[model samples]
Target: MTKKTQTPAVQKGNTDPNTLQLHKDPAQTDAAQIAAMALGSVAANAMTARSFAKGTFGTLDVTECVMTLKQRVDTTHGGDLKHAETTLTAQAATLDAIFNEMARRAALNMGEYLDATERYMRLALKAQGQCRATLETLAAIKNPPIVFARQANIAHGPQQINNEAISGTTTTRARKTRTRQNELLEEPQHGSTQLDDRTTPASARGHTAVEAVEPIHRTTKRRRESSGGA
Candidate 1:
């Protein structure tokens, strides 16, 4: 019986619950989480402000016009409204300042979060790529016992054992040579050359026109009057 080399999951060490290994790099992830949480806190505070948590005045209640025609009357709704309006206006300005501050803080926190997120995203992507490369290498060498031992002792240092990349320069050169040979030996076969119908052309133009047709099938459930059952 042939033994299976290594399962992809096993090779990648995906048994761990954490998508990323926390022990490998905890500080960075923690910093990223903190930034994200700070942004959330700022947003929550902004929401509370909108919910009138501090009772910021939305509108000032002003009387349209309650004019008294009585001469020497001790009552005055006009004065009361004027006083209320003046007080509310100043309060509204103060509320505006508070709202603006909340918005500023929220924006500032969000900016930090965005910056942190961008940084971590880049890091995560790089790590993910590295993990993928490692898994691929692991998978490629799982069957090869010699390579398995070589990869087992893999470590970062000045003496990095790299596989020399054989570039496609030779392949390109061969292709160019083949192209030149084809040019020298071959003639334009499509323009002037004629091909028999039975012998299909080496370079034939494909038919593009689609034949239009009327619908041929019809569905019927009724019996004809002349052919009706007696």
Candidate 2:
């Protein structure tokens, strides 16, 4: 038979436990809120870095430097200078590609940030709207409800009604004015029409399509008559 082992019971502590408990103090919470606000403020005011790699040795105007080097390379004929130029050109192109890649990555990061911010803003707006609706619903249950009076005085007031009526009238008047303007534009004054007729070529202004073709028909008839006579 296998020997069985029994586990011993843990003894209770004889000393009293410390009364102190971990809790967030109001001051600490306030400090954290302030810190968060400061961070947010800093972020809001911060400018985008022009160079992705700051303090790295070399000029930021890589393209301009490359162009200047190319100009020098064009003038250079010595083997040593040509070799140096070729090396430099290659290095400059590589640097340009590096900066380009950095800029591309930065743009992608900015776009992602914008998308996140936009989504957060939309969610915030929706939440705010829901909260407002809830508040309004609660306010509506009160004796002589404040929202109803405010809505009646401001939102659905006589002034608003009058404004709507005036807007409609103005819109109708505008439409009529536009129609009159269009008619005036399309049908010029009698004197202006006469002036236009005087300035325009007779063939272009006066002749109808069929009337314009009459000259061609007359020429064809004359040719036929001559041919018959001959």
Best by lDDT: 1
Per-candidate TM-score against the hidden true structure: 0.17, 0.16
lDDT of 2: 0.47
Best TM-score among the predictions, by candidate number:
1
For candidate 2, write residues 142-211 as lDDT tens digits: 3334332222235644555223423567898999998887667545442243324457533334435554
Please give the CA lDDT of all the candidate structures.
0.47, 0.47
- Candidate 1 per-residue lDDT, tens place, 95-191, comes to 4555455445445556567765555455545544554555454444444444322222335775655343554787799999988876654556443
Candidate 2 residue 181 Cα shift, in angstroms, is 42
Off by over 4 Å in 2: 1-112, 144-230
**Candidate 2 has what TM-score?**
0.16
